[model samples]
Target: MPKKVDHDERRRHIAEAVLRVAGRDGLDGATLRDVAVEAGISLGSVQHYFRNKDEMLRYVVGYLGEQVTARIVAGMRDHAAPGPVRSFLLSMAAEMLPLDDRRRAERRAGQAFTARAVDVPELGEALRYGDRWLHGRVAELIGRGGRDGELRPELDAEREAVVLLAMIEGLATDILLGMRDPGEATETVRYHLDRLTPQGS
Candidate 1:
C-alpha cells in the first residue's frame, strides 16, 4: 500500500518554506523552484500543491493571517487574566507588530504582498479582505470594553479600532524600515492604550 499523504502538513511545509525564502531574499526570490529547494521537496511536488505563482501568493496571505491569529491566541492564553479593554488592545497590537524574528519575517511577507497588491488582483482582494477582517475584530474587542464598563460608553469602538489598527500598522512599518525598535513600538502602543482607560481603573 502507498503511504498516505498528509495534504495539510504538506501545504504548511511549502508555505513555511515560502516564508523562509521571503525572509532571506524578499518575495521576488520565493519562486516555486526556490520554495521547493527550501522545503527539501521536489519542484513537481510544490507545483502539485500550487498550480502557479498567483495561487501560491494568495494562499500565503491567508497562511500568514493564520499564523498571526495563532500567535495572538497563544499570547492571550499565556496572559490569561482579567480581560481589561486597554490591555486587550495592547496585546492585539503587540501581536501585529514585528517584535521577534518570526514576526519580522511575517512583516516582510506582508509588505511584499502589499507592494504587489497594486498590480495583482487576487493579492489586492486578499489585502482588502484582511483589512476588513482586522477592523471588524478589533472593533468587536473594543466594543466588549464598552460592555465591561472599562472604556467610556460614548467611545466609538469602530473609530477607535481603526485608529489603533492604523497606529499598529504604522509601527510595524516603522520597525521594518528601521525607524523604530520593537520596544519603542510596543511602548508607544501601550502609552496610547493608557489614555483609553480611567486613571484608577
Candidate 2:
C-alpha cells in the first residue's frame, strides 16, 4: 500500500515556504515556481494544493493569523492563574510585535501581503476579516477590564481597542523598518497598558 499523505500538513509546509520566501525576498518574488523551490517540492505539488499563486497567498495569510493566535493562546496558558487584564493585553500586543526571528519573518510576510491587498480585492477582504476579528477580541478584553474595575471607568472599550490595535500595528511597522527597537516598542506597549489600568488595580 502507498503511504498516506497528510494533505493539510503539506499545505501548511507550502504556506511556511511562502512566508520564508516572501520574508527573504518580497511578495512579488514569491511566485509559484520560487515557492516550490523554497518548499523543496515540485511546482506540480504546490499547484496540486493551490490552483495558483493568488490562492496560495490567501491560504498563507490565514495560516499566519492562525500562528499568531496560537502564540497568544500559548502565552495565556503559561499563566497559572487569572492575571490582570493589562497583563493579558500586553501579552497579546507582544505576540503581534516582531521581537524575534520567527515574529520578524511573520511581520515581513504580513507587510508584503498588506501591500498586495491594495490591488487584490479578495486578498483585501481576507485581511480585513482578520483585522475585524482581532479588533472585536481586543474590545471584548477591554470591556472585561472596565467591568472588573481594572481599567478607567470613563474609557470606551471599543474605541480604546481600536487605538491599541493601531498603536501595535504602528509599532510593528517601525520595528520592521528598523526605526524602533524591539525593547523600546515593548515598553511603549506596557506603558500604554499601564495608563489604561488604575495604579492600585
Candidate 3:
C-alpha cells in the first residue's frame, strides 16, 4: 500500500524551506531546486505544490503574515489583564521586531519578498492588503485610546497610526542591519508611546 501524504503539511514544509533559503540568501537564492534541497524533498514534490517561483513566493509571503498575526494575537491574550492601551500597543509592536533568531529569519524573508514585490503586481497587491489591514487595526486601537483618555484628547488616530507603523518598520530595518540594538529599539517604541499617552493629560 502507498503512504498517504498530508498535502497541507507538505506545503508548509516547503514554505519553511523557502523561508530558510530566502532568509539566508535573499529571494534570488531561493530557487525551487534549492528549496527542495533545504526541505529534504524531491524537486517534483515542490513543483507538485507550486507551479512556479511566483506562486510559491506568494504562498510563503502569506504564510509568514499568518505566523506574525498569530504571534500578535497570542501576545494580546497574554497581556489580557490590560491596564493601559499603550501596554497593549507595545505588546503588539514587540511581535513585529526581530528580537531572536527565528524572528530574525522571518524578518529577513519578509524584507526579501517586499523588494521583489515591486515588480510583481500580485505580490504587490497582497502586501498592500496586509498593510491596509494593519493600518486600520492600529488606527482603531489609537482611536480607542483617545476615546478612553489613554492617549491625548487631540490625537489624530489615523495619522498617528501611520507614524507608528513607519517608526516600527524603520526600527526593524535598523535592528536587522545591526545599526540599532533590539532592546533600545523597543525602548524607543515605549518612549514614543509614552509621549502619545503622557503621564498626565
- What's the TM-score of every candidate structure? 0.91, 0.94, 0.94
lDDT of 2 by residue, 42-77 (tens): 999999999998999999999998999887767656
State how far residue 145 of model 3 sits from its true place (Å): 1.0
> How far does residue 95 in candidate 2 sit from its true spot (Å)?
0.7
lDDT of 2 at 18: 94
Please tell me which model should have the higher lDDT, number 2 or number 3: 2
Please rank every candidate by lDDT, starting with the best: 2, 3, 1
Candidate 1: count of backbone clashes, pairs at least 3 residues apart or interchain: 0
lDDT of 1 by residue, 8-112 (tens): 999999999998888778989999999999999999999999999889989988898788878676765654554765776787887889899888888888888
**Per-candidate count of clashing residue pairs (backbone under 3 Å):** 0, 0, 0
Model 2: ten consecutive residues of lowest lDDT: 75-84
Candidate 1 regions with alpha-carbon error over 4 angstroms: 73-82
Q: Every model's Cα RMSD, please?
A: 2.1, 1.8, 1.7
